[model samples]
Target: MAGRQPRRTRIGDAVVVLGVACGLALVGVSGCGRSGAATGGGGGGTTAGEVAAAVREAADALVDAGSSKARTSMEMATGGTRVTIRGEGVYDYRKRIGRLKVLLPQDPSGAPVSRPITELLAPGALFMKNRGAGVPANKWVRVDTGTLPDGNLVTGGVTDPFTAAELLRGARTATYVGRTEFAGVPVRHYRGTADLHEAAQAASEANRRTLGAAASEFATSEVPFDVYLDDQGRIRKVRHRFSFVNEERSAPVAVASTTLLHDFGAPVDVRLPEAEDIYAGRIAKE
Candidate 1:
């Protein structure tokens, strides 16, 4: 908000440890299992081309719906410890903005480490309050999404709802899993892998640069996902498995991010913090 530049802090750095452990665990488990293949009863006859095309159009479908309430979950596991971060919010597709209250997991002793963080997600920026590492609780820390590795995808812990759906634009391989009910609504499930580079090429102008940054910084450009689409082709639920290199560990970190959209056409009002309300001082590392 202020004209002064905030200290450059990599959001990804705070979550790197969780990523490394989760990535290693995923690799070990994957080696013992069969390839990820679609399984279920509905839409078995749908062709791969048809499924891919339908999945790719899901993002546009959401825009047509206007807005929705969203719930997000991000899980990371290493060794035997698994932690999950949860968020609930509302998003406006037309305006490309949303507000989420994110709760961090409890400490090992089952004690709360901090209060829930309030996050405002906009086109190219992220604003957070109660972020806690030496910052005033009343001030917000703003980060440019385009400057973040993974394009603020895994870096923010909770992937932005709009970006999660837009990622489907790059769907390269897909199989119809079947018909299912999500939040009491009928939906068709599809599973596939998307190329981040291709998604960046097809993404809207506001998201192109952010996603392109992710494509170049992640350990791999390919993202695996499972998505559920309603009758109108709107996304009911989507889950993305992201991998990024943890420089210190010299290994990839794996994060499973899930987003659920419902209450279509819900009212959403998100206001960005004023320049005077933003903290421009140096932020301490987590």
Candidate 2:
């Protein structure tokens, strides 16, 4: 928390995971950002061309701020299903199960892959899906809001919106990747990456010179960026893939939060089991 900015106490869903131990966090955002906009669209005087760049810039800052926290928000549409993901947390050290809160459309009710999806939060790839009904409702594991699979991506949901906006800000110069319609919205896609080599050099200089300079360099550390803006002039989709440069090894991942709350006005409590319960063949982290 020494160098981190004061984060917003978000409700509903935000991609923000705070890694308390390593002092790193991640943030993600949904397609429809909580920009405090009304349901009616096209009121803003800004065009897609003018605002796209700035939006991505805002998203990049959000990601950098959230990486220390281990959180993110990704908007994915598959097979007529619109998934607004607010993800935070990773389980294993090598990146295993991640935590997620999926906001699904209710009118159609449950679909095949209707439950929340978890991905790898540690510096690796991990995603699991329960295709069949073998898994029953209420059987899903419950965990704290700011906690991850093994406690990796906590508070990721809250941070995602900002990250998406920042990435879009940088994407403006990544060559106009053109536009497409996704989920009934016109999307403008742009791609770009952070200069890892330069980032490493700057880090080295800061270390050899002034610690304050090193701290500043780390704050502006670059990472890859991607974005897709919707027709309503909002972020419809985003996938900001970032990798740390000149890292001796992958950084450690941890989860931290003041508390976790749910949409139905409920709370998620993550606690350790008793010794007797462990002996009774009950072991699960939620």
Candidate 3:
């Protein structure tokens, strides 16, 4: 017992296991084509107001489109180590629900360390199977998104698609980077910063509390993002940079989360687990 780590410390460390393991480098994407560039107030005949308005309206546009197939990547860096987690699924924007198969990185030896986790994203809750550690293989662990320090944004290893789009509603300052082609589709690129508190204020009732919690707990409330929108104003892709305090080292951890949506009108069917199948016991820390 002399050299044993306390339970609290172990749990705190486990909280970031998915975020801190060594893994592949974050992928970089480049855009093709260019129209005009603008920054701040106005340039190239584009106004800051216009850019902000377009970015802010993206979420509503997604909802109107109905549903889409999505891919997500979250890269976290801390203490000089970086890791990436990737997920793919379909989301029904109108229903505010989705299902994703999240894949954790393999070990240093290239051996699979864990099975893919099945995650269900609902308005205010997150449900997961193969959650690792103490959770039974057949039972799902359910978490209230609003109770997480990062509002489940960075905690669950992948940002919820709806929440990611809603964050754009807080866009305060934006610049039209130029016109570009994303995944072979023509789109307008924009770079901007969003205030978490402002986003929470503009968010739907189900998301307000979660975003509010993130606003108060993250290292800073201002989130920097790059967004790509098609002619219909739907978000083709979005990437957000967030920072949060790491409880173990008392330092800030940098996180970069990317979401890509395609095939609008795609069918999505997500059913939450039954109450009896949810895990209610204390989770063990690895």
Candidate 4:
């Protein structure tokens, strides 16, 4: 706990943000048969435009699917420590409600810990439960995404289905990776690499967290995408892998995540934790 604590914290923050982005991306919209057989190939048979169109179609379908459950897994390596997170949750984009149970790495005492968090989109707030990390154990801190000092909370736009569609629409080099089975369902895979600058620019205005240099810096890091669509052209899974060097450090941190979307168009119920379960003191942001 004594060596390079701040740096490790930054790494943890980076990975956590990435995990949330991926998780949010997993629960939006759902649709069936949007992908067609006529344009499902990856190599000589498919063009970038076709692939982009397919992605856009799938994105729209997902949005239409309304509510669904998600299972997310993330892995990160920073310096010498490696950590993994597993999460399961239900999200209703139409109603802007979500509940998540995120399993974190073990504590210093070797006990497992987790952040049981929920989002009440009506007021655009994120409620995070305090684990035993110095904060009161019985209270849930409310973080108003709209009031954050930085535009960081707005990064949710990066995971928005429309934003994702816009990003794919700008992809000049997309290829069909061919048809395969994913999660026991037949799917067509497509791979695309978008220019970081263009990808950042393509984010919907509503989803843009910051403008100018900040946005450019976000794009400065490449985003390699692997998109999977079921037989009906409905999106079944999406994976993003990104890596960058921190400041002047040559050692790089890499993050990889995968999100699977299923149980499309399901009815969802998201209730806030009971008042008794919430702490009345000032909520601390973890």
Candidate 5:
């Protein structure tokens, strides 16, 4: 292990895997917004085709913007374990970087998982800052993205609005529900069903990896989604509920995920931790 980038700590690896699923859940919906009461069946000019077009347009616009602030809330249950996560962060699609503060659930081994960890990400690198008793104060523990197979890292790449638009490719049906307001912003809401695997297969090579990792559960399931968009076709909100039978428990497990995107063109400043703060010191391999 000498001279190599340190292997991510055990906990860091778990975070990365979870983030893969979380990022897909967070950024998988885009495009489609307010068009003033048009329905999906060509009612008053809102056809299913038009709805799909709107989603694609919105998704394009988000990718072009490069970066934004995101807030996500999620709940998942399997067997007797239930996990809830709430996070807010700045996501940069261009660099595949995200600086997030997340609240995690208890570990599988029954250890109480840490809450609200701040993380930095890239295609090959993931760094975590957890102010726990065993960790150094203000130091970031680096987690190698290679630790997980198939290109999963810290989860912010495809979550970028621009790349996330690829998810709409799997949409089987679309309906314009009517006008609404989100956080006082005039918007439009739409509902649809999509095959998660289809979208993953259509994503860009770089994005497909992250998407593929997250779609493992929903691969065989056609899930419903509710999407809200602003007048300019920017994504405002997206909601989805996923239900499946737990393979091990032979019981039902359901997950609800919601993402809110805002602060378009926000400044995202990410800095790696200084050297002195790192707890691990690697000896050169000579």
Candidate 6:
């Protein structure tokens, strides 16, 4: 195993599988600026069609290293630091079954550090695989849905915008908007929304240790998402908005900011936790 690439690590529903086997893809996107040009259906990509095209081209077009992407605009907060963010990622979808590396670049003032993070968004079931520098490698070595490993507590499984769109099969329902250029390439735009209730429930249950303390029972609302696609039907941007109709502003902190998606993939270590049996009982095809 010394020379072999690490197998995947599963944490609840997500799996992080990595091996030298998959083809690597890498591309740089010239992110749009202030006009809201940086996200799924916002300021840039001059035309909705252009935004869609960028997604299609990247999803369909395989690079020698992998494909790259960025998130729609998102408000990010951790500890006491808050920043508006547009996360970016690269992946070899053709290889390793969508192996991906996502990064949040340095802020405009270069005051905050940019993080290059790696994660796998499984084709189904909201499963994920992830890794990043400075983070405890053990977190990625296996499935761990504890608090944010990086201490950046923005709870979300589809942290990357495009993946959120792709998971819902946005290509099928997305309506064409217009066109614009991203990273010097033309992109087509599209939109769609699907429920993340199931994933959310799973996450809440997986982290039951913390959520269990809530004094009141909870009901989840339907999640509405804004999505974007390219010409070839590849997802470019995703915007997920969760509304809690039952809870008030006084609800648990996690109810407002945490996410539930966890890792699902091949096992990286030979020694399995006693909890492995629990995962084995899960309905998994990957």
Q: lDDT (0-100) at residue 106 of candidate 1? A: 72
Q: Candidate 3: worst 10 consecutive residues by lDDT? A: 24-33
lDDT of 4 by residue, 1-286 (tens): 1001112223323323323322111111122334443233332235665566576455445556677776655565654556555556766655556665655554445654555433333234456554433447656645444343212222221232333333443344568988889888888888866443454355434333322222343424345678887755666787666553443345545555556777877676777767676655632223
Candidate 5 positional error at 138, Å: 5.6
- For all the candidates, what are their Cα RMSDs to the real structure? 9.2, 15.3, 8.3, 7.5, 9.3, 15.3
Q: Which wins on lDDT, candidate 1 or candidate 6?
A: 1
Best-first order by lDDT:
3, 1, 5, 4, 2, 6
The list of candidate 6 runs beyond 4 A from truth reads 1-74, 77-87, 95-141, 144-162, 170-175, 197-221, 243-286
Off by over 4 Å in 5: 1-45, 77-83, 105-115, 121-127, 131-165, 214-221, 244-248, 272-286
Which regions of candidate 1 fall more than 4 Å away from where they truly are?
A: 1-45
1 or 4: which has the higher TM-score? Answer: 1
Candidate 6 residue lDDT tens string, 1-286: 0011111111111211211100110011221111222333433354555443343233232221134433333443332344443333333333322333344435445555534444443222122233332234334433332332211112232343223322232221234566664444455544433323222222212222212211011232233444443333344444444322111122212111111111212222122223332222222221
lDDT of all predictions: 0.73, 0.30, 0.74, 0.48, 0.55, 0.30
Which candidate achieves the best lDDT against the true structure?
A: 3
Q: How does residue 202 of candidate 1 score in lDDT?
A: 80
Q: What is the overall TM-score of model 1 with all chains considered together?
A: 0.84
Residue 262's lDDT within candidate 1 is: 94
The TM-score, computed over Cα atoms with residue i paired to residue i, of candidate 5 is 0.65
Question: After TM-score superposition, what is the CA distance of residue 193 in candidate 2 from its true location, in Å?
Answer: 4.2
Give lDDT for model 1: 0.73
Q: For residues 137-212, could you state the per-residue lDDT of candidate 2 as single tens digits?
A: 2233222322222111123322222222322332323434666665566566545543322322322121112212
What is the per-residue lDDT of model 1 for residues 205-236, given as tens digits with 9 covering 90 to 100?
77888888877765467788999987777888
TM-score of each: 0.84, 0.32, 0.84, 0.66, 0.65, 0.38
Q: How many backbone clashes can be found in candidate 6?
A: 49
